[model samples]
Target: MAAIAALSQNERTLRYVIDLPISSTEYNIWKPLFKLFLSVKDDESTICGRILQSLTRRESDNSQISSYWSSMLENGLLSTLIQIFSLSKNDDALTSAFLIFLNLLNEVPQIKNDLDTIKNCFSSMLKHTRSTNNQILTLLGRVLSCLSTDKLLIDSMVEQGLIETLMILIDKQRSSQIIYPYFDCLANVIGKSYEYQRKFIYSKNFLLLIVRSYLQDYDLNLSLSVIRFIRQLVKNNEELQNILAHYGVCEHLLGALSASSKELQQVSIEAIQALSHKNQKVQQILLREHALEQLLNLLERTNMSTLQVAIVCTLWTLCENNPLQKRDVATKIGVRKLISFYTIKSDEHLLVVTDAINELAKCAASINMNIQEEINHAQGIPYLIRLLKSDNEMLVLSVLKNLQLITCAPGFIANRKNQEIIVKNDGIKLLVALMMHAKCDIIQVESAQSLACIALSNNQCSTLIESTLDFSYSHLVDLMHSNDVNVQLKASNALATFVYNNSRVQLFLKNHYQFSFDYFQKFLQNNNESIRCITAFQVVVFCGLINEQKQSVNTAVGCGILMDILRTSQIDDAKSAAAECVARLAHMKSGVPQAIIAVNVIDYLCNLFSSSNDTTIGNASVALGFLSHIPEGRRKLLNRSQTSSIRYFKVLSNNIERSRAAPLSDYEKEQSSTNIMNFYLPNIRQKV
Candidate 1:
């Protein structure tokens, strides 16, 4: 301690303390000793002239000295040093205080709670921001950067017209390089106040000041820092959406996209991307200016992880809103070239690849169509198929969804051999794997939908039914029991289509898929209305579409289930679906009409006459009209108890008798009698 204090007094031995361990308590004892060595604090020696000699000693030793200085900054000593720091007039002493302060603030909990005290001290420092020594201003800038997030300190700085002062220091050609720290602090403070962007934007001239400073200075770090603030300012302020319409900031930022510093180029790219959000005019300008080419050039040269992330994000934005731009860009830089970048081994790069692929997949469906010929020439399917097995679940799901979109379009999967290639390459296996094992229900549902689409292709349709009917039927039943409503809805829809297209599928349903009907009924009881509606609708579709030729007996039971749906809950739509399903089944040769009449179809149809929804009433009326086509249904309608207060039947009979028609189409006569039956019938609430 004595040795460093003596050196500080002479300016010769001070260099030695730079090598001493600053983190150790023993070495930190010298911090108190500096109070006596700082004679220049009272003298008029050129601040830099007095400080340069000692700074030289520590120039190559910032780490060791920073550590030792930080160890001395616990609690009481920090306050005493702040007091001494306030009294120093020499720029050298001010610069040294900040250097030591930076180290002290780096200790998290120490300054976290002391922000108020620190802000008060900083207020005193800014009073001399115009100190003739540029070094002092620069040191103060560094101190401000460390404390920029502190609200009180920022307000204090803002009160002093510090923005103009920092703008002066940002002029690197004439300003000292030390001013970069000040620029950093200024940028960070601006970034924190996004919610107040309007207040800040309208109240201050920060944009003009930064743009002018950037034009003159052109420092990569400073320009990048300012660009980040611009990003934040625009992000939190919707009013700034039209910035490019007025200010030339967009042009300067585009120019910066070509900067030599990869970091600066990325910041510029990110700023441009942020500006382009929902601003088609800004995107058009960038596109017209060929800014994308500039970004791509940077992507090709830089392999830095952050740069790649920014580049991917930029490309993703351009691609999502404007597919023509992506297709055009893909024409110049082949899709494979862009996708192959993900093959880079770094985990960071892989994370970026995952994000990029997810974004790209949103546009992938569009791209696959526009570039199908070109992709076929390049064999793009193989690349897409490879991503299906990627360890990343999200990436796999995204790729699967895009591939499905490609296959879903008309005539895209026409070739039987090309369709088989997916199965042969285990693509179907992967879809099945996702259906069974993927952790996310959304992914599983998407995969299941994709499989159904693939099975729809004429080339693969019948064969897919024959080979996988048993397992797929069972799987669909199990997925119907899934807690995920989307999964159950999709799985049920797929199963309906399967049973409709293949009569043989009905045997499996009878033998192996019986559990599905019970679960389907449970789904109808789900609290989510969409789930209940769709589940009931799907069960109706399956029963209505079933093939009586292959499994007549089970089809009879399916018909009874449809009738039970109506009787259990005359929820207008469920009743309508039940009625529609009955109409379809009655036309079948399976004696489903006998089953329907036995379930009291006449009473169920009359209950729907009071339904307020026109469609529900119309559907129930239409189904009753179909049942009236049968002789036995007419007998059941007239067999009701004479004493029954059938309000609806009375209305129908009066309407029919008033019309004076001895003869009526079975449809009209049945509708008339059902309406009359409804008037005499008491309102009945059926419980599922």
Candidate 2:
């Protein structure tokens, strides 16, 4: 003790004493030694600087300094430092004291980790943020941001009026001096706990006050810090986001987005994105304020992945399900340039870019040609196709949606390049994989519909051959009866394409298929009218082309199902489908006899013939003309004399003759006019 006291008298000796590195030591000696130069009443002017310097020096060494800090904190050394910060007037003294606290809270976390120490520590730091000393306030901001990691200290700091103090600093000060530290303090507190967040959000319009400071045209650094604080505050809190947006604070954020500085632009883009998330009203507000133009401007100026991510994400929020806004963004940032980002960004940013593109595709009716040509020109289809092989369900689902959009666009089919992309990328095989076996029902439904579009675009049946070469016919058939109505419709439509003029496919089904037309006939009665319509369409196509297999269809489809579709369904397409299926079957042996006894399709056809729908009248007339040759069918048709439309069936026969007479031989033409019944009835008589 005598020796240490002798050294403490000299400045150099005292400096050496303060600068000594600490190891695990006796707390009793360390506290008294530290107290000589540390505290509000720090012993010497030079001693406080030396002490902070020693702490700073120790911070640079990647060694354990916590034991030294832990010993001081245990022995009230922290209390002494806080007392010095509370009273010190010298910038050197205050600055050194602030650094000591930052290290203890930030570097030597053992002190902050102790609940009892941090509790008092938080109170002291909150007290210091209100300091008139700018140096103290700045250091306190960083300290609070650090200390806020303790979930336990969250309510303690809020109760100490921390939020109110920070709010007052930013609102009242026009100077940029305390801006970062001021909002940094609030961001720390609000980020720690939801209770604290609500307290700030609901109190004094705390968030709006921070946003107002952002508009002060202060230093770019200060505006960025304020924006960061705003982002941290409302990031996941939908309710608080609503409050800020309601107060028109989101407009200021948009203003910041249009600022000249890139940093402020980046942070503001992030802030707007934070507010726009999951809050539909705020998205509308952002769109109304022309935030999309601001975002495109930023995207053009910046190449940083982080900034690009922010801009892309903001576009995503602004454009989802709102096609007009999507077209607005897509036009400003050309579709070609937008899709060109696919290969440049990392995985995370790529996700944001692709999502923006995906949303834009929703307005395909308006933006189809521009986007389709660019996608084909960019060869982007194969890249999107490969994403379906990913393990991430959301990524794969997003890719499926974009592909679906591309396949169904009107310009997509006419271009042929886009359709070739789907085929060239083996999109059908991937879609079929997701359709039959994906775990999520949504993925299954989307995949099926995508495949159905590809089938519909079969230019010469080449797409069908490419898709169904390794395809599971059984899986496709099974999807026709799936519990999901979308899956059923898509499956039935694909089946129509699969057999359209592809007699090899029909023969293959006949040779290897297990389900009868009965499986298809049952879906005709499904409550969904579209499903019934599509099912009837497939039944007609199948019965029309497979003349050699006509008897099996007649037995499986039967007359009753056809009549039910023709009678019960109000859909014109569905009734037309039933009439066409009935017409196709009328040529087979006993086909008319079955209709007369089982389902009474002739009476339904007669009723169809009297309709105002041109499609219905033509279909009904054709089916009746075929039936008029059969003994029982003619008897049934002759019996329904109640309506003049049915009695005027001969007029329909005259129209069919006139339309077909143009290409017929002279003998056939004369014969067609002689007997309208002879026009269609010969097939029945010849087959019988």
Candidate 3:
């Protein structure tokens, strides 16, 4: 019985080794064929082709064939095969040899060392491409496609004018089988290499050829290949995208969205996305082509998650910074569809979905209040708030940012409702938790920023935030001491916004959490310019919200720190913030004005009146106005040497006149202008 088993195994091995139609698990069965091919002395023997066919089959059978590569190279099998390819006239022999070479290029890492020997065969392949045999042309194109993977071989192919040859063949070849391989080869050669890209672009009518080929093709496979080529060609190349847009490539890509094949539609969508990225001309062209209408239709019809994601991404690129398109998307209920992406629970899908929602929210927040309302009415808020519990930090950050945009865009009056919705959903608790306990500093910082946005000018949200069990003023104060400057800045800003004009919350913090000016001194003197700027602004908010009689808080954030900022800080925003803080302190009238005057801040304040920053100039005028209220500040202002006190007063008075004429409403400007006219000018006139 053992002898019979051995006999059966031997028969199977002979069948596999002799190129019969059989299979075996025996290792290195192709070695016997390699030995037979090597023993053949005649270069014209058909045995070479047979052995090459066996090798190709073995390579396909096992991808882990690199173990035999060293022995094959030692036996000069690759050189011998290339020799047969160059000299053979039989199409079968040529096709077999080309397949083996293609396989070698893919599998053997050591093949790159022998690139010069292989490069000598490109001329022979180019010659055979002119043959009327479709099989020869297809195999030649495949061989070139495989060779195009290496930079050295790509340079060789370009130097030998393979691109020009392939383009010529593409123009002449009417067979889709032949043309598909040529397009594949060209795409491979031009894969992200700037030199090849430039050559393709500069070539006369090359892009036109590609667009025409893609738009006119009937075969789905050929169209897919050409569109993929177009995708690769336009990736990150805005110049090529614009040129192709002029050639009507975008219109054709949009037309492809209606294809029956899902794969063709997917590739076509990807191609359109690559073309329209950051290219406003292409984006406008796509919009005019009814891209939004078709994409929305596809989004509704496609159950394939990847295709849906691609369609959503294409919509995002088209609508980015294009308000006309965004408004159009909103008109079509596109925001509702975008909100639906949150239902997908895969982290990959959620990350993309959250990013799209965030960007759409940002765009809508800037110009369209109705869109923000649309997102809210679509139940976007609860979906976003629920994502806050995700273990993925990036997804949470994206949701937080989207929530912030919805609640705090500058002109978005509907944010009041969004803020209320967030609070209703317990988003405040989740945000506070992230701000206090998230491991990533960026997440912590973004969480704090989102919280600040929620609390901005909304007393209801502020009240809820102040009462959340896990949240406290101490948490914010602790975050302020973080080693990261951004963390410190964001935490300080959140604290300030939490307390801004919310006197109840402010009182609660002071009475329960020991919130004081002492917590801010370190930030006031921080070397980071942004920290100093935001810290000073926080102090401004703190002083403005408190009673004027709280001199200890006013004096604790010393006039000298602000004076030093005005004297030494280079950033105009920081200087403006510092000046504003000084104005807040001086308005207290608890001898802080005299202290500012005593510190000689009057000279710095007067000097800042001529600054380039409008905020700085306005805040400086207000600080001087407050200083002029006190008798001591009045004496110092009227005694300046370089510019007359009356001249400074005239500049202040002119600023007030300009404020009234300016179109935008500035509350600080209105209040300061009123105060200057009502009180400071009378004192200045009496002193003058």
Candidate 4:
């Protein structure tokens, strides 16, 4: 320590001390030497510059430097440095001081504890931000950026007019070196504080000025900084996004997509994504600007996996809920490009790309687009099924979701073809594995839903799913016992759909597992509206599929639970589902219809005929229709008090007949008309 102090007295040998490769054991030597240099008291001393350079060199190890900084802080080094930074007019000294402070604050987060010292230094730092020295301004800007990480320091900096200083520097500064850091400082400081963001945005048209700069500037670094600032500014703030959209920010960002620099394009795409996420107005703005065409063009031309991923994400965000854009993207070969990203081996890339494809497939299925066919034609199924083996739960979930959407297409042929492809590709095995063994509840739920989608309305897929090892009715019953409501809901729904019209599976479940009436009552009585609603639908499917199970289900569930749901459920869908369950029970040959009438469900059914919800009306109509199959139900329908109910039934039947003018075949129309007549006119002559 004494030798180190003596060496600090000679300027020639100080370079050797700075260049010495000190091992970890010798890190203690820096503390006393730092103290000795701080005692020099000369703001312009070369010792200060040499000490700062030595400190910067030792910054490679964060733990060692953090410890060294902690020791130095105990020795009044922060006060001395703030004094040097305030008093020094020497550029090299100021630069060195700023570099050391930046490194210290970045490596040792505990430095934020000394908020008062940093607060005292803000005025000096703001004064230097106006410096003509590019190096001084850049270094000071970075130090300010680091200081912005502390909330209290940011408040103090703003109080000292840091925002005004940064805006001034950004407005007039053209040097990339000077502009980048200032923009970065503003992005960090204001981006973290909502109050500062408001002040910066609403104080003096500062937001407009930044947008103009972003639009007019073409320098790579400056443009990147501006876009990053904008990205952070509007990250989750939709109102600010709309304000930027009013200034045509989306159009300018779309133009950036055509830039030659991949990095610029990537950042620009990210900024656009931030602006357009879930903002339908901004999404429409981007679509009008032909963002779809330009992004697809860039996607085809770019070889960078990251840029491709960004483009795919932006495209999906724009196309979501916008069917025209979804069709346009499909026409522009967007589906093919999205599928091609699966060939990339990087996990991060695969995760993002698969998510995008999943969303795209969802939108396509909603609008009945041929995207499923397109994906299959592009050979995208194998890639998706292959990704089901990924260790990343999110990736596997996304793949399963894509498969679910593909198999659940509205068109029968498309649905069957996709299911066949999945079955042929061993997709069922992978999904069953995830469903049984995945640690994430959400993954298990999604896998179960995907398997259900495959089995929906397809006997082949249903049989295959049932035959898979450990994925039979017993496994689904086990899944229904999980603590997670979502898992239970999905598993129950899967079981319901699995046995829907599949008499063989229904018999298998009946013979294998004891149908728990208490469990079904608990599910129906769950507080969550979705759970109750799905449970009711599950009951409907169960009673409708198997004749032998209806009596037991009716005796156990009773018509009273369905009546309570129909009477008390706030959700229209839940009411409709419960009413449908009542209709299914009324069809049972047992005394279920008599039990339903005992609940005085006749008046409620009559009242539901005037319901505003179409599904409710249809379900109630069907319930009353099935109830009319009995002698007491016919006598109740013919009562003089049920005149309006009878008239409503006649009108609904007429509407059904009018729908025969639709695209239905003669046989379909005849069968549907005959079914409606049988329900309403069972005893019409006796009633009149």
Candidate 5:
């Protein structure tokens, strides 16, 4: 059998396997061809690849070969194969062994306990790593890889110290033939436990070792391999940051930030971004090291791919922590450079440009020194306005959010002259259209935020913003309960800001007709912290109407439910807002507060006067003051001993003391403009 196997493996017959007829009964004639492969005299990789290729292709559905192979293995054939696999010096023998194992392992349970005997055959081969022949290790690694996904098989191999062996191979000096098999082994083991892989790769001290080796390595190929491994580590932000924090990575990364190769700079910047997010110390270190300037420089000169990645990372690290970071970027550059960069670049380059612009808008929210100046100078608003018509979901989101912020900036309204710029070029209508048409939750949430920003300036903007309020209410309400936490926060913010004005509130109630008070009632009882908190607050604000026209019986009943949500256990802001609504309702008409008491709202307001969270506390005070304005509301409070009003007054007094004592960050001051305009706008506009 060995001599016949040897006879068929000579150079002349390899062509025959490729040319063999699909139906040839001679297929079985090649069943023992692997034994011939084990004896071949060959140095060519192609011969090895070809023989394995023929075996794999033929073995595809060849159950006869499988059965025959199984019968051969069931006898003493396993020992001769083990001897050939161990003793053969030719790559062809190793390739044949790999193919045979691949076929056999597919029917792994058939090998059953005998599989251990076969695997034991490998214990001797692994010892051959000490030999000058590394192909044995490579081939063994490949054989193990084929079985790596089988938990039972891998667990057995691991018990025999296979992971330690594979790591040694991986940690060895680079050899082209050895590296691929090591990567394959790594991929297999990582697939076993991603967390375990991450721990080793991103360990605080070990990551520096990898980065230092990568930086000092003279070989570009080796450097790229190390980078690819590090890139996997960067996927875990906290892990990557913790690793980066162990060294002066900010300066190290900033030095490399300007590498002429775009790929190198991208990887370095990504690692820095990951680090910043992982540790606030990294962020402070970056800030101290002028990391933002280096990043901005990178943004200015970076290629499209690099710039997009840099912008995204910068935004994630900077804007995620403080809206002020976004504001600073906007105020410094005015978004003119960034917007013009996007406008002039080809559509293919637009993605990176869009990322920069989106981050700029988020940071710049209503903070530009001259909103109109920046918008006009960059030609930013018009380009973004046009993007409202874009088919791409992300583009629409970017455009909408920036435009929202731009339109909301103080003194952003266009006169007849700037009207073409503001309304036409920037396309306010398209943004309004998105309230109905956008399908993505992010786009919808951002669109709502945009609408809120646009409504910030004046009654004119409000009238236009109010037109979309019904559509906004429908989606905003749904998103307030979204599974995505960010969407829920953003939508809650949008509703709180936009719904504050009487025009939008009236428009939403009348048109969108928030008839499903029951849905909101259920949401208020939800276990989600943000949902319950924001929903409680927003429902109360919704109930308080300044110029609210009389509602139909159904709308009035919905209003009663709003009062109930406020009066429920742990009403917090909801209770305070409900009390304010009772005041507004009674003052608007006597019938409203009478209807509110029917829902038992006074007890709820009394409970919230002592609540934490400045919003609930302040609203409670204001609600008590408003209640003191209404005869029946005042009587209800007085009948409850008037201590509710006194407690609220105390809460208000304490809030003022805290406000005076607590200093705001630049971002806080920046964010304050939005809150100020949101809550105190009508009075401020009236005074103006």
Candidate 6:
């Protein structure tokens, strides 16, 4: 097998008109090829053409042959090729020289690490392109484009009349074999660096040629090259989309929709999408050209996700306020077909399909209907709900995102339809189940958000959710410590709603108060800032809403955590939450006020009274006024030590005479705490 492979390579090498050289400086591999160069003065063009062809072929194979050729060209052999190139008159040797320069300019400098050789070669090619030789001009055009990536080489090319020569070719040259290369050359040059792009962005003749010539051609390669060339012009150039539109380039891009090649179809559609992005008037022009119908037809013939994405991307631009396009897609492309493509595929395809669907949802929801009807028609709602139960974390995230967009997007009729679909497909229950997912925090977070979306709607949906299911409030209680801050936030958000004054919810919380408050204590002590914010939310929600949960079984540890967070947290949200929790507990007749004062809670509240933030100071004042209702708590609230005001309040529970003298009354407690709470609660809300 090895001998046969060698024979195949030998036969391939035998077809070359000149022997391949092996050395850069030495003539060891050069003797025979130089003999051929010396012997074939009349056919030097033929010999050089074959040599260039073999060099390109071996390099394409990515073998060591490119290195060998790089070594040969980096030495004296470069002058020999240039010499032979100058001697031939048919423009054949010029073509061969430019081809070598094209390949060698990209590969040789990279291999030899010689930029001066590249600069010298670029100067030679730039000089040659000024000739009336069309074939030589075509080859040198590619050479100039390839070398334009080097700032120094581009400077030299500009000095040596490269732009003038290209302008002449584009104005005079008619053959696509020549014009195709020049347009492709322009694309390469424009993509090199910002300087080249800036220089060319205003070149009217070059862009006109790019927009004009290839559309009339029968060749797919030429047409596709021109489309890509124009893409290079307008990609990030916000000003050039108008240039493309003014010269009718976008009209021709729309014409690329009928292309028989899938690759051309994809790129052309993408170019149109990129150009028409912020140019809404151009989108109206595309719609007037019936671009939406072409896109609908193309969307049906292809299963390629990329092409599908491109088609929808362009359609999204056209459909913003163009109700005609939206109605057309609804009746023709059939949103059900688009929805049915989601089968829990790879994450890449999921992102594409979901993005397209999201765009389509935005468009369709404006005039026609919500996206859920289409999803329901295709049974996508069921699959998406089942995907929520998937072990693949990415799939779960994708489904949650789609569900969130559909369920949360604004519009009464639209929100009703989407929430109805989720309920009908039992998606709400699945999402509730997903909240317990421990491995993927995104799933837990988004699932909680989706449930919030369903439960918080103002219609009868909340009542439907209230009667339908059994929730794992215990799981939510456990997830309060779920390592992920976002999970903790979302879980608390959902529990706040689930336990919103419903008797069963209160019973569940009353049963699990000890377990739930344990996470709150740990959360308040957590080092993470976000966890601390979550801890604050947890405290306020648990204490403010659930009167039974707030009727306080054990307030010692809870009081310490609340006071520590109030003292330690710099964020007003955390400090405010801790104060608010204490205020709520103090309002109840539980022994919370006695426990709070026993632990120097009065000192924390006194410090907050001097705080810069009005919200913290007010919350602290309300908590103190509520504490002042009790005989022992009243002494702490009123006491002012000679050293620091907060010091006497710190140990006021230990002073028996002061406690007996204060004899607190319920009327004073209710009136004072109510006035302080009413004053601060409004300010506290705006801060949170």
Model 2 scores worst on lDDT over the 10 consecutive residues at: 659-668
Q: After superposition, how far is residue 399 of candidate 5 from its true place, in Å?
A: 5.4
Every model's TM-score: 0.58, 0.65, 0.59, 0.62, 0.52, 0.53
Clash count list over all predictions:
22, 1, 0, 0, 4, 0
Candidate 4 Cα outliers beyond 4 Å, as residue runs: 1-79, 89-96, 99-124, 130-135, 146-161, 171-176, 190-196, 345-379, 386-398, 405-426, 433-446, 452-469, 474-493, 510-688
lDDT of 1 by residue, 1-688 (tens): 4444344465445546545556544454444444443454444223323343244234454444333334334524456446545666766556665655554665443464565545456556666665777766666666777777666556666665666566544543245366566756766666656544554456335556556555346766567667776776666354674653356677788788767787777777788778776677777777777778877777777778677767766765655575446645544555555566655544434443444433333221121132333333445556667677777776676666556544432212222433455666667767777766677776766677667656643435546534652335566667767777667777776666455334455555756544335556666667654355445445544663333323444454555556566667746556655654554444333355666677787777667656654334444544554455466775565555243345445433432232222233233343444534322222341110
Top-down TM-score ranking: 2, 4, 3, 1, 6, 5
lDDT by residue (1-688, candidate 3, tens digit) is 2122222334344444445433334444444444444343444344555544554455456456634455456657676666666666766666766777776777674586686666566676687777787877887777776676666777777777788888888878868777786777787778838778777678648678777764687787689889888888888888898988998888788888888999989999999988999988888888888888899899888888778878877877888775445545644546777777767544555765666655455431211133467778889889889889988887887888888778764221226778888888888888888887888877876887788778866666666776776766677778777887667777777776666545666776667654455566677767776466567656655664345437456554555567778898777767777776675555442355566688887888887866765446666765666566566676676666324546556656554333223232132343344444323344545466
Our model 2 lands, by Cα RMSD against the true structure, at: 11.7
Highest TM-score scorer? 2
Ranking by lDDT: 4, 3, 2, 6, 1, 5
| Per-residue C-alpha lDDT of model 5 across residues 1-688, encoded as one tens digit per residue | 3224234445335444434555335354444544444444654333543544454444347445533454345444456556655676665556555555655666544564465656566554555454455655556655665666555565566566665675555556346445544444544555455554554643344455555643555444444444444544444446555555555555666676666766766666665665666466667777777877777766666557545546545644654564446546544544566566554534644554555555443211112133444556666666666667777776666666566545542111212223345655545566566765677777877877776666642456656655643454666767867888667766765775565434546565556544344544665667653355455444544554322423344336445555655666464534544444443343232244455654555566556656654445444444444334335555665565433445454444343232223233233344333433111112322243
lDDT of each: 0.55, 0.62, 0.68, 0.68, 0.52, 0.59
How much does candidate 5 score in TM-score?
A: 0.52
* Higher-scoring candidate on TM-score, 4 or 5: 4
lDDT of 6 by residue, 1-688 (tens): 2122222434354433224443334434444444444344546445645554454555445565454464355445566655545444546556665676566766565633343454354445555655777777777666655565565555555655666666676777667766666666666666655566676656776667666765767687778777877777676666777777888987788877787888989879878876777677777778788888788888888888777767765776667564445545644655576666564344434543454555444321311244555665677666677667666677677678777656643211125566787888888667766765546766776776676566543335556654445545666666666777667766775675454333455566767575345556566666764455445544544564343354343334445567778778787656766765666456443344577688887777677655544345445555665566566666655453323544323322222222223323333344444433211112222243
Give the TM-score comparing model 3 with the true structure, all chains together.
0.59
TM-score of 4: 0.62
Q: Per-residue lDDT tens digits of candidate 4, residues 1-688?
A: 4335444555346446534677536654445555544454554255656655564456356436533455456656677678766776767667777777777777777877785655467877788866788888888877877777676777778888898888877777767766786777777876767776666556436678766755677888888888888888777778888898987788788888878888999999989988988899998888888888888888888899888778777787787775445645655656787678777655656765666565456431211245667789999999998888888877787788788768763211126778889999999998888887788877876888788878866777887886786775566778778887677777877777566545667777777665555566677777765466567656655664334465556454545566777777677666766666675556543356787787777777666666666446655655665566566675676562346646566644443232222233222244333443333443653376
What is the number of residue pairs that collide in model 3? 0
Candidate 5: C-alpha RMSD after superposition:
13.6
